[model samples]
Target: MEHEKRDHALLSASGANRWLACPPSAKLEEQFPDTTSDAAREGTLAHELAELKVRNYFYTTDFGKRKLNAAVKKLQKEDLWQDEMMGYTDQYLDYIRVVAMADRIQGTAEIEKRVDFGRWAPGGFGTADCLLLKGNQLHVIDFKYGKGVPVSAEENPQMMLYALGARDMYGILYHFDEFHLHIIQPRIDNVSEWTCTEEELLEFGSYVKERSALAIDGAGEFCPGESQCRFCRAKAVCRARAEENVRLAFSQDKGKLPPLISSEDAGRYLSLGEDVKKWLEDLKEWALGECLAGRPVLGWKAVEGRGSRDWIDMDAAFGKLAKSGLAEEAVLWEKKPLTLAQVEKLLGKKDFQDAVGEFVVKNPGKPALVKESDKSEAITNKVTAAEAFAEGGES
Candidate 1:
């Protein structure tokens, strides 16, 4: 797909996250242009399956309980509930009402025409997913399953953009007083929701259209924070990201910096360390690339640094042990793992004259997770058990 076309798809919260993090679209546009990852394909499949499951719950069963069971079963069959990593996400807030069936609205049964919500770019247009009627209100639901932070359906620019598109699409065919944007995050442990007035949606739509035009026509580039950069498609070529990687190599401890400014600001401030380290790595890459091209970095000083000691005196020590007629294994040197802090403290100790000593360290282990019962469960269980007894009217 063209970069512009892909950008429209990415306007959705999840889409933006994917573009910033993996930059698959930019990578495809650049080198090895027609490649796709299996992981990405699998993720799409999982979402399609999830949508089908939710649709079945509403359209198939009349009874709420039966619909729920059927929806759960359908989800299971689609392999959504089976794939441990793919199906179950740690971030899911809640599974509100799985396979929730909704009553159809009067005006939503008919299809709406596709209209240009607004111009994303000179030639680009933003479009809505679809408009469904649920009772008297016009329900607009957007599906998002990515691990990125979830976007609220209410007042979300993306949803507002879609609503604008829907308004243009419906035009004279239908009149919608209230616009509801429901965000379905099936991948999460908890389902989230957001709602907005039609007026709010219209205002958001206008704001984003102007913003989009500015972004596309504007000079320079979108220099979002590292978190936003995580999803940026131009990351490999992005100057900000290159600087971030360089800085990360130097600063292993994040807590050393002052907390006055945001960590992001601190990172930018620390970009100097990254620049130096990145320059070294770039030099190495250049040298290697040159050698491969039959041009070598001749006469370049290969500086040496102090490295770990060689066991040169070990043979003499072993020979002495043999001379003493004792086990050679007895003279073997063994080292133990130590934390950086522990090593530093030991180095300062006056009694530790020898540079070498065997040290052992082991973790105490994980703490157990047991909580006092609230008695709520016991009371509920007893009440339910008694109710069942009354219903049965038997022992």
Candidate 2:
């Protein structure tokens, strides 16, 4: 299905993770006008390209190949196509094909499959990137082209909703026993997979039914958190979220007291860190948006941003150089192949392992101050929990 045909509803399945947490966000977001960024458009194109490639592999190659090429050329014409985008899509295709190899004889695969959960969520519908079914198990593969943050599949509400929707769509047709959720974020080398039985999925459906009803009717409370408000449209103007952050961040640590943080307070601060970071970023963006639109905030005003220059017409410049009779090699130099990180991203983990793994040089990065809950060990070896307090430093 073409992404252009995909409609944006106030309670979309993609934003289920958000609205389910902060139920009022569904209604709050409606008040703000919907707008798509260039990144979103590029992601749409990547999804289109991925759909085309997967379809070609499974069904039509000669005819579908033509359509795929045409779609790519159109995107290239608009300067939306990039080498990196295709690499990401290719990684998605590679994963699908690899999984297909496991059940090559019995598995059924569908691309851009639509699922509707309007029974619980009013007008709830979304297209799954890919679904593979075999015997009683179904695999739901979602391709996230974004590189900003690594998304995990373990108990991920978004992927769970996709699984629920898939079950609703194909439950009767195929009596699947297990649903496997796969989130392949090629840019971040994040390939997380989680499996849940039909019982677990149905249990989640109960939660979905209760929360979705509230969100669809705009009746649930605005309980704020990092996961919910990170991409929320109303986060900047969310009174509940603002209040929650202020309340969480306002510490009662007196100067007379010991600098050591109690275990409970440390836990609380850790939970607040993500939300505070998101709130600060969202507030900055909101202020900037308001200022750019000629409605500057009373206290915070906008200044010219750090800007860079770009070539007006690179082709024109190259064309003139071509006619000047200078050696082509002298005018334009060949670039070396991308570095390890770049090549790994270009080829993906599996392909990179097959092609470039032998060339990788492993090294440990210098660790910094991370939460006590972090998996990695601390860089400073002297102290552990209250290292900051032991030293003459603020906790």
Candidate 3:
């Protein structure tokens, strides 16, 4: 599956959350060139593969099937391709089938449909991964291949913008009464959805119009917060964000603490700590980049950090070890069983479950403090302790 090239809007739907919060950031980010990371490239590959599968399944023809097979072969030859991608994509396909069945309407499914919402947002348009229209209902399904952060469909600016664009494009023909936004993150096993009435969707569209007007010209004040700043291009040197985190870090007089801090103060500091840490890391990365580019930071200089050596020819090295009477299993190599996930992918899901499902057991995850808005259910201390004890006894 070859990657498709798409033009990005200045106020891209994907970056709407950032620009909507801090309007000036849309302009501020323009000074920096857009860059793609390995993770991003891998995600692009995954999306391409997914689109191929969707087209093949929904609009199947002999030629389309042949094209799909050829594309899959090309994707497999890519450097980023992994064996697990097939299984993950199959899961996504299964979910799409379920959604189609639930819709109960033999509606049309468009792949990589381009939509425009320029009526509300100036020059706002994006490609939706999939759009299923079923009897006055519009379904926008987005595939998120990244595993680092779980994205939700509830009031998500990106998904909302996608939905808005979709509606503008299809509303006249379909007279949509409801909009369904879905995010499927197969890598992290997250599937989230949010449905909105036409009235609610229009109300949100008006809000987006107001914000887009401000964001297009970078007319609003800089609002520095965690979620918006996380992916901002200028975050490394953004004075507003720096001041925000710095003020939080030194809120107490002389940056000092009392002899004993109250629990409330401790909780506040802990929440602030994450932002401060991220800011510090960004600052260091910026300085390193400057130094590497031959621009001197006040007290920084680029230098070699560390290095390690590896065998030039593993087979030759191992043969030499054997000549010295070293047992292959003793030092050269050792056998280990595949991890649960690796085995699951190696054998299909049903086969793997039939083979070793009884031997497999899942332990309770460790408890961690998170924001109240997190979707995960809160665990009580009693349950945590009991689960810990149960695992200990089993061991």
Q: In candidate 3, where is summed lDDT lowest over 10 consecutive residues?
A: 1-10
- How well is each residue in 114-199 modelled by candidate 2, as lDDT tens digits? 87777667777777888888778888899988877677788777677777777777878889888888989887788989999988
* Better-scoring candidate (TM-score), 2 or 3: 3
lDDT of 2 at 390: 63
Q: Could you tell which candidate, 1 or 3, scores higher by TM-score?
A: 3
CA displacement after TM-score superposition, residue 331 of candidate 1 (Å):
32
How many backbone collisions does model 3 have?
Answer: 0
How do the candidates rank by TM-score, highest first?
3, 2, 1
lDDT against the true structure, each candidate: 0.48, 0.80, 0.86
Please identify model 3 stretches exceeding 4 Å from their true place: 1-4, 253-258, 321-331, 365-367, 377-395
TM-score of 2: 0.78
Residue-level lDDT for 129 in candidate 1: 34
Q: What is the C-alpha lDDT profile of model 3 across 1-395, one tens digit per residue?
A: 24547888887888888988898899899999888888999999888889989989998874387899998998899898887787778888888888888946888898888778787789888778889989888889999899988898998888778888888777678888888999999988999999998888888889888888988888989999888999999999999999999998887756656789898877878888778889989999999999999999997788998989999999999999999999977887988998998998888777899999999999999988887777789887666778788888955
lDDT of 2: 0.80
Q: Which order, best to worst by lDDT?
A: 3, 2, 1
